[model samples]
Target: MRLTRRRLCSSAIALYCLFSLYAAYHVFFGRRRQAPATVVRGLRKGAAAARDRHGQAEQPPLEMEEWNPWEGDEKNEQQQRIKNRLQILNKSTKGKTHISVQIWSKAAIGLYLWEHIFEGLLDPTDVTAQWREGKSVVGRTHYSFITGPAVLPGYFTVDVNNVVLVLNGREKAKIFYATQWLLYVQNLVQIKKLEHLAVVLLGNEYCNNEWINPYLKRNGGFVELLFLVYDSPWVNDVDVFQWPLGVATYRNFPVVEVSWSLLHDERPYLCNFLGTVYENSSRQALMDILKQDGHDKLCWVSAREQWQPQETNESLRSYQEALLRSDLTLCPAGMNTECYRIYEACSSGSVPVVEDVMTTGSCGNTSVPRPTPLRLLKAMGAPFIFIQNWEELPAVLEKEKTLILQEKIERRKILLQWYQHFKSELKMKFTNIIESSFLTTNKP
Candidate 1:
C-alpha cells in the first residue's frame, strides 16, 4: 500500500463520518437499551425522600349510611287523634257503644244518626234550608278532614271515637262535633275455636285490612278451617279464588266457615224473612217472590257501595225512594260498611234486613251491644228475624207479611227513640265533661 498525504486525509474523514452515524443511532435508541446507573440512583433517592416527608396523618376509611322505618310517611296529629280517640272510647264505654263508631267514625255516625233520628221525628224537606243543611237526614260530601286531633278531641276527652257531641246546652242545643276511628261492638265474635286458616283469600285485595279472617282464626273461632280463594287487601287485584284439591286442604270446624261479609253464604235470601213490618216472616226465601211473581210496590234491589247516579237515573233520590217504598230493606257489605243503603233504608221508615246490623269494625275496642236486634225488635213490636240461610226465608216472610206495614211504622219509632236516648246520654256526658273542664281550668 503506497501512502499519500491526500489519501490519508480522505481515509480519516470517512472514519469520522462512520463514527458520527454510530453515535447518533446509540443516542436515539441505545439509551433505552440500558439506563445510566446514575439516573436510576437519582429516581430511587427522590422517591425515598417524598415518602419520608408526608407520612404524618393516615388516610381515613370510607363510611356507609343508616336506615329508618317511618321514612315514607310522616306521623301527624290526625293519625294520633284517631289512635287516641279509639283508646278513650274503649275506656269510657267500659267497652260499650256500637253500630261501631257511626259505622265509619263514631262522630260522623252519631251526627248522621241524629239527623235521621230527628228527621224521623220530623221531615227532611220541611226544615229551613239553612236548618236543613245542618239537620239534613243525609250527606254527600267527602273530605279527608283528618279525624284524630283538633276539634274532634282525642281518646281521653276520656274523649271518644265515633261519637257525636252536641256542644251547646243540652240535647236542645245542637251537634257540634263528631269523633273518629270508632268501632265498639265490632269487637265481639261468636268465636268457635280456630287456629290458623289454610289460606285466606279476599275477593278484594289480599292485605292487612282483609285480616278479619285471621283475627277470627287466631281468637279460637275457625280453629279447623283453612282459607280458600277470596278477594282481600293482601292480593294484587279483585278476582275469584280457586285452588286445586291437591293444593288446597284443611280440617273442618264444628261451626260453618262462612264469608264474614254475609250472614250465610248459601242462605242470604233468608235475610228477607227473618224480620218484617207488614209482611209474613214465615215464607220460604225466594218462594214468596216467585209465588206472588213479585209486587210493583214491593220490589227487591241489589246495589254496591259505590253506586253513582247517571244522567237518566234517579240520582241519590232513587235510593231514598226505594227505601221509602218498601217495608223491607236488604243490605250487604261492600266498600267497608253498609254504605248509604243503611241510612237510605232506615230513613224511608223501612226495616233493614241485615245479618250484622248490630255490627261494627274493631277500631273502638268497646264492648259489644248487650240487647241485640232481637230484643230491640221485641221492644218495638217490630217483626224482625235473623236467619242463617235461604231455606228458611219464604215461610218466615209469608207469616210476617200481613203484619209488615205495622212493624215498619214501629221500627221507625224505635230507631228514633234509641237515637234520642243516645243524644240524651251524650248530652249528659258532655255537660259533665264541660263542667269538669271549666272547673279544672278555673282552678289554677
Candidate 2:
C-alpha cells in the first residue's frame, strides 16, 4: 500500500469522505431514543415538581410573595396579619387550547349578564368552544342570552366537554336563555362534523320530552343522555318517562347553577378577585381600613368597574401584597362572589369573609363551596365564617380586631395549602368535563 505522497493524500481524503458518509447515514437513520428519553425526563421532572408543590392536607401554607408577612419587621404584628389573611378561594393555571369566539352583536346584554353568571368557565382545563350565531333560530334556546348561531344541530354533538356559547341579546335574558335553548336544541340539534348523537336531558326539570321519549323508543340504544339543566326541582321530579342526562346527576354532584358556561369542566383561573360589589364593598372596605389605620398603601386595589373589558389582569403583584398585609379580607357574596375573587383571596392566603348575599339578583340554584371556589378554601376544613345575611356582619366582626385577625389567618393558611397540592387534580377534573362536552351533544 506504500504510494507516492500525492497518491497517499488522495487515499486518505477518500477514506475520510467515505467515513463521513457513513456517519451521516447513521445520523439520519439511527434510532432517536434520545428524543423520547428527553421527553420522559421532562415529564418526570414535571410530575415531581407538581408533587413537591402540592402536598398532603397538612402542607405548609403556599407562599405567593417573597417576604412572608409573619417574618417581616415587627414579627408579632406581621405574623398576626399573615394569620388573618383569608385563603378560602381557590387558584389554578389557564393552559393552552382556548379557542376564540366572535359573537353577532356588540350591544348584546348577554356579555355582562351571562358573564356574571358564566365567568371563569374558560378557566377550566377542558376543550371549550364558543359560537356566535346571530338570531338564527327563534326560541331555540330560551335564554335571550343565546342570540348566537342556532347550534346547527349536531355542532355540539360531542362527549366529555363543557360547551360555552355566548350570544348577544336584549331584555331579561336569563330566565329565557336556559329554558328556551333546552327546547330548541333538543329538536333541531344535529352533529355537523362528527357522528355522535346527542342524548339531551333536562337535569333541572324532568319534563316528559316527547322527542327523546320517541327517539329512545327507536334509537335510544345508541345515545348518551347529556344533562342541560340540573336542579332538584327539575331533576327530582323528572318524569322517568323522559330521557335524563347522565344516569342522574352524580350523587356527589353539588347541583351548582348551570348555563352555557361554568357547567363545563375547565382549568382553574390564574387570578380571581372576590370583592363585595356594594359601594365601599368588603374587599375595598377592608382595604380602606388598612390604609387608614395601618398606613398600608399596598391595599389600594381599583374598584371592579375600573377594569376595562378585554383587559388582562395585571394587579396581582400589588393586590397580593395588599392581601398579605391586611388584617382581614371580606368575601361577601354580592356582585363579586364569582371565581376570580375566590382564587385571588385563596392563593394570597387572604381570609375571605364570605357573605351570603347574592351577586346577581338571581343565580340559578347553585350549590355553595363550588369546586374551584372551594379548592383553596377547603369545605368544612377550617372556619368559613359564613354569614347568612348582611345584618349579622356587625355581631360577627364585633370581636376584638386581634381576635378577628387570628380567626381569618387560620382559615387562609389552610386553604392556600390545599389549593397548592390538589391544583393539578382539580385542573384535570375540569379539563375532562370540557373534553366530554365538546365532543358530545345534550342528546335526549
Candidate 3:
C-alpha cells in the first residue's frame, strides 16, 4: 500500500509542473500574438456595426482638428500680406492725382467710359477719392461710384477735386437729376472750389437743343472737358466721342478682331438693312425704294415695325454674320444720322451707305455750317457712301455691281486699316487731353 501511494504523488507533481510551464509561455509570447488578432477582430465587429446602423461603411475620423490648431494665425498672416501689397502700390503712386467717377450703373454709356475709355488711362491707385455713400471702392483705385439720384445728394458734401459726372441725356429722370446736380456743381465752380470737372453727356434728343444746349451754354466755362455723343456746332465746346460699335448691345462680342478671311468670302447680298421701320421715317422711305427697284432680292433686308431692346443669341450671331458677308451695310438715320450700325459695319469691313440728310432735329447751328448731316463721319474721313435721298440707291447699286473681287478686297483692307487707326488716334488724343487738362494740372 505505501509503494502505490508514493507513485501516485510523483505522477501528480509532474502533471502540476507541466501545467505551470504552459501557463508561463501563454502569459508572455502567446498573448503578444493573440493581442493583434483580438484587436483586428474588434475592428471588424465595429465596422460591421457601423454598416448596419448607417447602411454604409464609415471612414476612420481624420485628425484635422489636431492639424489646424494654428488656423487663426494662418488667416491673419494672409490678410497682412494683402494689406502690405496694397500699401506698397499706394505708396508708389502717392504723387499721382486722384479721380472720382460718379455715374449711374444702369447707363450703358457709363460702362463704356469706365471700362473701354478709362481702362488704360488710370490705374487702381490713381482713383483714391471716396464718397460718403457708395458701394465698396472699385478696384485698387478706391473710386467710390454713387449710382443713383437717391445717394447723389450725399455727394454734395464730398470733395470734387477731379470728378467725372456721367449723365444719360435721354431719360427724363436722369435729365432732371442731372440738372439739379449741375446746378450744385455750378455753385462750387462759381467759387472756384471745383477746378477739374468733366461731363460725359449721352443720349442727346434728335432735334431738340432746349434740353442740353441751355445747360451747356450756362455751364460751359465751369466744365473743363465735355464728351458728347452727337457733336453740334450749337454746343461748340463739346468734344465728340463717336457712337461706339455693338459694344453696348452684345457686351462680350469681339467687334475689333473680326476674321478678315471670313469677311472676304463671296457675299450673297449687295447690302443689308436689319433695323426697325417707323412710319414717315427714312427707313420706310428706304424700304419703298428697295421694293420699287426689286433691290430686296439683291439685299438682305430684315425689318420689324417695332424696335426690340434685346436680341436672342442666334439673331445676334446672324446679324454679325450678315455684316461680315454683305458688301455694304445700309445705315438710314434713326434719331440721329450717326448710328452704331455705321461703326459696326466698319468693323466687319462692310462699307456703310449712310443717309446723309439731316433728320428734322436741332443738331447744329443752322446759320454757320448749314448743319450738314453726317458731318462727324465726313470729319473722321470715313470711307462711306453718303446719299441725300433713297432715290440714289439704284445708282449706288450699279456702281457696286461693277466692282471686281480684288477691288472689293482692297476696299475692305483700306476700311479696316482706317477704322483701326481712327480708334488708336482717338485713344491717344483722349489720354493726352485728360493728362494735360486734369491730371497734370497743379490747380487745387
Best by lDDT: 3
For 33-134, candidate 1 gives per-residue lDDT tens digits of 454565456456555666688754332222211122243354565688889999997787773312211111222222332333322222233322222222
lDDT of each: 0.33, 0.36, 0.66
Residue 176 deviation, candidate 3, in Å?
A: 3.0
**Could you estimate the TM-score for every candidate?**
0.31, 0.34, 0.62
Ranking by TM-score: 3, 2, 1
- The parts of candidate 2 lying over 4 Å away from their true place are 1-192, 195-317, 335-339, 358-383, 394-400, 403-410, 420-444
**CA RMSD per model (angstroms):** 29.1, 22.0, 16.9
- Sort the candidates on lDDT, descending order: 3, 2, 1
Name the lDDT value of residue 163 in candidate 2: 30
Residue 346's lDDT in candidate 2: 44
In model 2, how large is the Cα lDDT of residue 205? Answer: 26
In candidate 2, position 423 carries an lDDT of 46
Error of 2 at 76 (Å): 59
For model 1, the superposed segments whose C-alpha errors exceed 4 Å read 1-298, 302-306, 309-313, 335-340, 357-392, 404-444
State the lDDT of candidate 2 residue by residue for 60-126, as single tens digits: 2234112322343687777767666533221222332332122211222233222322222222222
Highest-TM-score candidate: 3
Q: Judged by lDDT against the true structure, how good is candidate 3?
A: 0.66
Worst 10 residues of 1 by lDDT: 244-253
